[model samples]
Target: MKASLETLEQHFATVIAANELSHAYLFVGATNSGKMTLAQWIAQRLFCTNVKDGQPCGECAECRRIEEGNNPDYLVIQRATRTIGVDEIRGLKQELSKSGLEGRQRVFVIQDADKMTPAAANSLLKFLEEPASQVVIILTTTRLARILPTIQSRLQIVTLQSPTLATREQAIQQLGVDSTFSHVLSTTQFSLEDIQGWLEQVDAVQLQQTFWRWLTQILARKDSAFTLVQTQILSTFKEQKLQQLLPDLLLAALSDLFTVKFALNRPLNWTNQQENLQQFANQFSTQQVTALLEIVLGLRSMQEANVSFQNVLEYTTLRLLVVLA
Candidate 1:
């Protein structure tokens, strides 16, 4: 669920009323944290002829056009092929200079602005310094440090955080999922639709079977069999899919170890494998579970370092096996 930023919304409306809104705004936040949604809201409010209470009325012709992505004044600059290059920035400059097609301002929403290449960043600097009077540039990125300082300097920063758990639950309920699925979905900061789509594609039964087999093989010190599992995941699942699932799996493994230590409610995600987890959980102390979580976090960093996924899982499994032994 998108957390409404009432303060920011009011600030935006005041800025608009004063005709002093910044030419560029950099929205910094994690993925799916409502940055994009908030940006669109602000754009709609700025362009809407009949705004109310710092929010867009959502009934006017401008709002409808923007909602449908057909507003001539709205320009979205997303990565065309995983990178925003200088060529794209140059073309945007040409477009920004033109008159607004149908509204007060030409809104340029740059999604994943962190993907901008060095050349593109430099090209964007010129526009930021001398932005067109009737142009609004909204840049959204998860990695603010990657953006050039010059670019950051020309923009006001809008920070968005993950929504609260209660809000997330309400959102899940609105999507018509049961309480059990909602509990699992709460582990992430995604919307209900996003979670449902991911779960629909995940084939969790197959993953659980493979994961259980892998864990058993590790306990038995079957390096060859574990290597095969690693290779299979690398070849079959997309990199992003593995990245998402592995974190949840790591968290579940840590929780299982803890539950075994303290005899708490069975570990959340892997509760179905309680018997197997319990066998080792009783053998390990709570400190060991904490240490295991630390190791998993380090492995997560390795994955983010762009190391091959196969290497990460292989190295991670070996380390865990050694620690358990």
Candidate 2:
């Protein structure tokens, strides 16, 4: 099941209702952040005939055809390739030259627009300058910084926030993780696909439990925090998974603690330790939390510099202890 984008869904529906929708849009977010889902929802909201309460009647002929990928007016350009080449953009441009088969409105969605080669991007850039009146071009990308400023300036940008903690927990459960496991896995900013990949390679739940214990020990200022790295963390988790997953989890945890310091009503990745985290948050000022975050980020960069994973983790723990002190 997909997590609901209730606010964005409603806003797009209202825009469609008023006929004030823009002809171009750029959806920006990390993977599994509902970029494609929101694009399809907008397509349905525009094409669905039996509208309900500013939402699409998903069962209608128009919506079903769109869902089944049989709609003549709706087009999507996405393929499994390292980079989108110039020829593909030509095909889209050729298609855009024609009138719609079924109606006045036509929707074109380009997934991973950031994958376009320079030539392909230039071709698409020309199209974005002037388009058919009722045609809408939606481009979704995980890397907005890579896109050219010329292309970016042409479209109305829509950003999808990271999924909620409850949404992520549900997704993890659906991956067959035990419901009894602490919801710590939800705190890491990984896509469900990436999470599934790691889960297949290692016992993520067990590693999370170990990490949680180590984390709590660190916050409690216990001496055992230093030894837990060798005894629990390094022993239980595979090196590859540790390199891939641990740093991001650490960053997410540090980010949540930063969020906690301000008493913000935001979701925490470490929901199970909310009480302890808040108590810890109270002890540190905002500058201290920022320092902690920078330390973790520096450790991440050290990994890129080919520092051994054990050294990175050991050093991270030491620096955290020093900073939190």
Candidate 3:
């Protein structure tokens, strides 16, 4: 469990202790926001052999089983493909209908609930109309807008707010990123998983160091980035994977730099390089920054064309020089 979710833990534990648990709950947040962890915590609290004030003894056998993803009464339904169809929901419904004559509690967690097709959502909606008191259904999704309105209204809504800056930085550090680079990486990437995935197959530290160095050089020189581009940007980041990510990185880097001009409330990617960012942003009028950002924003489409990643970077550099001149 994440330290940032301590408040949620306290609130939920009290709810469980009071026996006011809702039969169905919808957890909405970014993928790495700990929704699944919270669901598991609820299960452990209910099934723990030694329960105290809604908190479970993590050492208990049942708690261990759930932690290992093998608890018999706890079933997880995840989308195996792009869409979860009606059959999956139907299967879950059938399982719930079985009479336990002995009556043991059962928990079903559906991951990426927004991936469910209309038919599947409708099937689940019918089940929600009259839920079984002994059964619990938990749905997790990153996109609440994609969830059907009728279904959304039926379940208890749990909105996980964006992680605080301290929380995000701490998580980035735990992922083996350097403390110095954590702030920049966290600002560029929305989630910890995204940061991890974005750095995949690349030397994370090298990418961080080289990228910032290259960006700094370009900012300091207004005439041309040709020397830096050839010596640094082109020398490294040659692989297809790195090329594929260049546009996104450029967009994020520039967007973060833009934050300095407006007293923007969002995080900055290069907080340590505030002077450089301010100087770079200061040279550009509002109209110029807007145009430069627009160009970088369109770099994604440029990547999809026959243009090489190196070509894209060089082209972007040329555009920046043009704007400065």
Which prediction has more favorable lDDT, 1 or 2? 2
* Model 3 per-residue lDDT tens digits across residues 174-290: 988777677755544246655676567566778866777776666665444666667777666776545655666667678877788776998666566677678778876877777
Q: Pick the candidate with the highest lDDT.
A: 2
**What is candidate 2's lDDT per residue for 15-120, written digit by digit as tens?**
8889899999999876678898898898898888988998888999999999998998899998655578999999999988787887568899999898788899
Tens digits of lDDT, candidate 1, 1-325: 2235666677778887788887889998765677777778877887787887767899998888888888878888865355788898999999999988764678899998987888999999988998788888999987789899989988988887767766776777566655544555566534455556655666545555566676666645567645765565555455465455665666666666676668775435554566777777766767666767777778766865678777788887787777666
Model 2: per-residue Cα lDDT at residue 269: 65
**Which portions of model 1 show Cα errors greater than 4 Å?**
1-3, 29-33, 52-55, 79-87, 97-99, 117-123, 142-150, 169-184, 189-193, 212-225, 228-239, 255-278, 285-291
- State every prediction's TM-score relative to the real structure: 0.75, 0.59, 0.67
lDDT value, residue 261 of candidate 2: 88
lDDT of 3 at 107: 87
Query: Per model, how many backbone clashes are there?
Result: 0, 0, 0
- Model 3 TM-score, 2 decimals: 0.67
Task: Report every candidate's CA lDDT.
Answer: 0.72, 0.81, 0.77
**Candidates' RMSD to native:** 4.3, 6.9, 5.9
Evaluation by TM-score, superior candidate among 1 and 3: 1
